[model samples]
Target chain A: MEPNSLVKLNEARRERQAAILLSEIGKGRDRVIREGDTVAGPLGEAVAKAFRSGKSGMFELDGQEFFLNVQVPAPRIVVIGAVHISQALAPMAKIAGYDIEIIDPRTAFATPERFEGVALRADWPEEAMGDGYLDAYSALVAVTHDPKIDDYPLIQALKSNCFYVGALGSRKTHAKRVERLKEAGISDERIARISAPIGLDIGAASPQEIAVAVLADIIQAFRKRELSAAEQAKGAA
Target chain B: MSEQKLTEHLAGNGPAKDELQVAQDWMREGRNLAIATVVETWGSAPRPVGSHLVVDEEGNFEGSVSGGCVEGAVISEAAEVIESGEPRMLEFGVADETAWRVGLSCGGKIRVYVERLG
Candidate 1:
């Protein structure tokens, strides 16, 4: 084991980046492979699969054994509302293994008493997550139902490539929002990724039931997320 | 976020200490340490392959490669690996009854690779 490999891997994880510590069994060789770093051949394919699944395991390449200690940053949720649905979604998302944070500029709604144990921010999404909270591993849901409050984060979530970007609104409301996003230079393909009228097609009537539908939708998006290799490494050329 | 923020246990999930961070901290402190990882497993191994257990010179350890079933032996071996700076592969299973008094209660076999950090 290389002494620096452990430190590097830890650093990558702390920065919310995915990494893999590929260690040769018994041979004492090791290296850290960050997301997007390319390796060639059959071993590369195995590494790619491991990165997608975030599963660490033993691998045999040309009869030589190696252990891939793959690490994918835990996925999370960023909510752009402190509404009734978010109040329910916050706790339920955490229970579902997705850390959640709610950002709402409306002080009256963002009160700690309302959010209880959630990671809440009373500031606007532009203020709370302006430094790039939206990422490929995060699910962004704008449930404020107000364009003034929800539009910025929704646009940012699309540009930042959040795995799940959902907006709360009816078909009529989404049609207007779509025009706005298109005018803002968002490509049609990326705009199509938003799950407006958010949540699964379950007959959820109350805020709590809607939270369940949204949580299930987020899980499905995360589990079935496409492992596109293009986003693995940024600026490594 | 820093490791501290990431590990704040903010969510309701179970605690998962970043064992590699602990290992790095020990290394930075100039403490002789060894890392033991479950490189391979068969049957009902408690911990999955690539699970790590980092041990310091004073016999202190963090993480687990097994369900507290074979850590004592792995840690003792790690102390020697730290001293000799040599990697070793140790196997434990029901079939290796002659080598270990302690075997996986779940009837699994695992191969652990212990190596010095340096």
Candidate 2:
């Protein structure tokens, strides 16, 4: 092979090596949870508990308790609106470890200049939310507050295991939206997943406050599931 | 042991270790290891539940279960448990002065379980 090809090969090898190294560390981290069943009985149980609730579990060894949760990868935050809240929220959500994606049909709002380094999708919600868009590790926040755009994604988001689904609107607005969703055939339970009025009641008045409320609600939803599961397990027992 | 540093590591793209080599090292070591996990927390707990720290026979450690409060105590305890091939439940809280002396600042309490892993 030529020298250039050799250099290229060497670089490729390093890249591949790095990639493998990263994956291996991840595997090592998970091995106690995966192959852990045969080796450690309680580690497997801890992982099972973590998977069920996405929270950590405690294991007792040598008369001492150790706490661990399944290493849950951060959820993907796909915002279907590039409004002011999105501007404020995308950065905060990214800081919170959400893989943030902002979608808007308007070029002015959706441009790289506006979002800079953030994932910007200049497409309709229906289009942007394609390809198994929502997953267990996804939180869909509809700050667009425009029904024409927000409704479709809300419907689509309800069809997945999104951990948090929130939309910015008042109770009256949500009620109207719910009526339309009902007309569109959305069930009461699925519609219930949406955090309408969108946020913890931090007496939020500004766009930033609203974003904080919305993020707070999302975090609460994430943490609440763990509590609910524990309650369920206790009830079962 | 810094909460911010650990979150930064986990929240970023992915892990920074080699898979085959780590797997081979694990395979070579081939003994059950005990993993202590923090499952839940509230109110200024040193570390939230779900914090993790793993230990083997050699006293080598990776990860943290508390901000810095009880890891030393946990590690020493975990090594023996890993060797004995049994599990134990550990709790740390500021319910009393002794508990505070263990350094659970903020009066927070956490429950942890440590079990051996193969």
Count the clashes in each prediction: 2, 33
CAPRI tier of model 1: medium
Q: After superposition, how far is residue A232 of candidate 1 from its true place, in Å?
A: 4.7
| Candidate 2 docking quality: incorrect, acceptable, medium or high | incorrect
RMSD of 1: 5.5
Local error of candidate 2 at A183, Å?
1.9
- Best model number under DockQ: 1
Clashing pairs in 1: A36-A232, A36-A233
Error of 2 at B68 (Å): 20
lDDT of 1 by residue, A1-237 (tens): 798898889888888888899988778899999877788898888888898788898889878888899988889999988999998898888877899999999999999999888899999777888656776689999999889898899888877756899999989999999999999898887789899789999989999999999999999988876554665322111
lDDT of 1 by residue, B2-85 (tens): 233323422325366778888998998999999998888888765788788999999998887775667789999999999998
How far is A39's C-alpha from truth in model 1 (Å)?
2.5
In the order shown, the chain A TM-scores of the predictions are: 0.90, 0.71
